[model samples]
Target: MGLSHRSAQSHDHWFVTERDELHRSDAIELNGRSALNAAGIDIDDVVYLDLYSCFPSAVQVAVNALGLPLLDPDRPLTVTGGLTFGGGPGNNYGTHALATMTETLRKDPGAVGMVTSNGMFLTKHAVALYSTTPPRDEFRVTSPQLAVNARPRRVPTEHYSGTVQLETFTVRHDQQGLPERAIIVGRTGDGARTWSRSSDQGLMAALETEDLLGHSMRMADGHVEEISAVSREGLF
Candidate 1:
């Protein structure tokens, strides 16, 4: 078994994200491929997968990072259905995945399994590998903050007054499953990212059905204008 825990250093999840960062995950501290590499294991040798799937994006990130198709009958992403079909157990979800991996490996000798877990807006990452056969070398546990911290991190612009491109956002719903607010991340003309929020009912409604990315958002002195005129306000 091998385990690698990593950090992006910044607490803000969107500090270095882009429109496709959720899938590409290049800015993430460590991915399953790298973790497997450090363990002297080839990704092609793995036979089981248990990627963290608290959300579809989490699995998408893993799929992109590990070079996998989103849905494959021969190679489903998880031994267990993950948090989607099963209830999320917070960080403890990995325990259920590991137990499933054990059962899977036991069913077929010499099979390999991999598990990936993340939390807190992708700021933290953990990857583990298991094999029915003994590893060629000892498992290495690493927390390489120094290497990760060396990567350049973008600082959020404190103020902006220009046309912003809506990059990505998520609508937060209430107990009744109604969208009450939306969190947004938009990029300036020069590509710097900023965070904002909106509670406009009409806009929130449209966000659920609209492809709002690349829509215009005018911000000046902490005031935000909407996308496609469907929205009229936002907060930083």
Candidate 2:
């Protein structure tokens, strides 16, 4: 199944779900729910459940759906070394968690170990469990009811239908006193899908000198680059 992690902003989320017309998040939630359903895990079988913990939202959504309380004071919150502790490598690093749990179960025998994997900036999620002995506890996490009930409502309806062609994209220069941000330049579209164009003196000047985030920019072609205009509407 596909997966996605959207930013917390309403605009950014709309770009992906509405403008891009992607349903990756919906597919991922369904896939997870299907796996739990097929396993026949009841509340009793679930000794513990650890949702992917990369960011706070992931854990919050899962607990709310499964009706699990937040961390218990008596129980240690972390069972494995966190990412900060070098628990694993990037996306695929979660494989390392499997290796760690294998040894932990071997020694504990009847004890259980749980690990959660977060992919693509919390866009995807995974939960794994291990026990030297056959599991006597049941799995009770229900279908992703929270997501199903709350569907996406806002998305970009219009693409940059304007006549814009991407000519080139430039990473911020790191020369002696160069700016510390990336920049792109191309032709402006007719206002259809998102488009880019050459940087004008006005835009180039800002990128070359100013500090801005999530704004629209255009560069004018001339003897020297000129920034045409800047938008503060939070377009990154």
**Residue-level lDDT tens digits of model 1 in 1-236:** 32222212212234445323433454333445456667666667777888888888878876876677788888788998887775555568878887878888888877777777777776567667776677666656555445455554544675677778776788999999989888877777665777777888887887789777767887775446667654423412
Which segments of candidate 1 are over 4 A away from where they belong? 1-24, 27-29, 86-90, 228-236
lDDT of 2 by residue, 14-76 (tens): 233232222134423443444444443432343433345565665555455344566765333
Winning model by TM-score: 1
Scored against the true structure, residue 107 in model 1 reaches a CA lDDT of: 85
**What TM-score would each prediction reach against the true structure?**
0.79, 0.42
**Candidate 1 at residue 114, lDDT?**
79
Find the 10 residues in a row with the least total lDDT in model 2. Answer: 1-10
